[model samples]
Target: MAIELAGRPHRVPEGSSLADLLAALGHAPQACATALNGDFVRREQRHATRLAEGDRVVLVQPIVGG
Candidate 1:
């Protein structure tokens, strides 16, 4: 299936979970915040949240400031 990840089109395996997508993209589950189709998905839910075709995923990482 194909999904819009951070505004770019990407393909993932069928029945892929958010955690799987993150692993495929080289992101650590604990290092970023994720939103699915404009709604926030908690960290613990990543493993259970299955992504569908055309779903929008946004990943944001925390930045340290002075």
Candidate 2:
């Protein structure tokens, strides 16, 4: 299946969860915030949040500031 990841098209295996995608991208689940189709998906829910075709996924990492 293909999904719009951070505004770019990306292919992923069928039945893939958000956590799976993060792993594939080498992102630690605790180090970023995720949104699906413009809605926020909590970290704890990533394992259960199944991704669908054409779904929009955004992952943002926090930055420390002075």
Candidate 3:
């Protein structure tokens, strides 16, 4: 499936969850915020939020800068 993450196209496996996607992208699910199809996906829901075809997923990591 072709899902867009942070404005970049990504090919993720079928039935992959937010956690799975994050892991594939070399990111830790514990350290990021996720949005699927324009709706914010909470941490508790990441395991259950399955990615669908043509779904747009945006994952942004928290950054602290002085």
Candidate 1 lDDT over 1-66, as tens digits, reads 999999999899999999999999898889999999999999999999999999999999999898
TM-score of 1: 0.95
Q: Which residue pairs come into collision in candidate 2?
A: none
Which candidate comes out best when scored by TM-score? 2
lDDT string, candidate 3, 15-47, tens digits: 898888888878876888989989999998988
Which pairs of residues clash in candidate 1, taking residues 3 or more apart in a chain or in different chains?
none
The local distance difference test score of each candidate is 0.95, 0.97, 0.86
Question: Residue 1 in candidate 2 has what lDDT?
Answer: 100
Candidate 2 stretches greater than 4 Å from native: none
Candidate 1 off by > 4 Å:
none
For residues 15-41, what per-residue lDDT tens digits would candidate 2 score against the true structure? 999999999999988999999999999
Candidate number achieving the greatest lDDT relative to the actual structure: 2
Q: Could you tell me the TM-score of candidate 3?
A: 0.87
Point out the worst 10-residue segment of candidate 2 by lDDT: 23-32
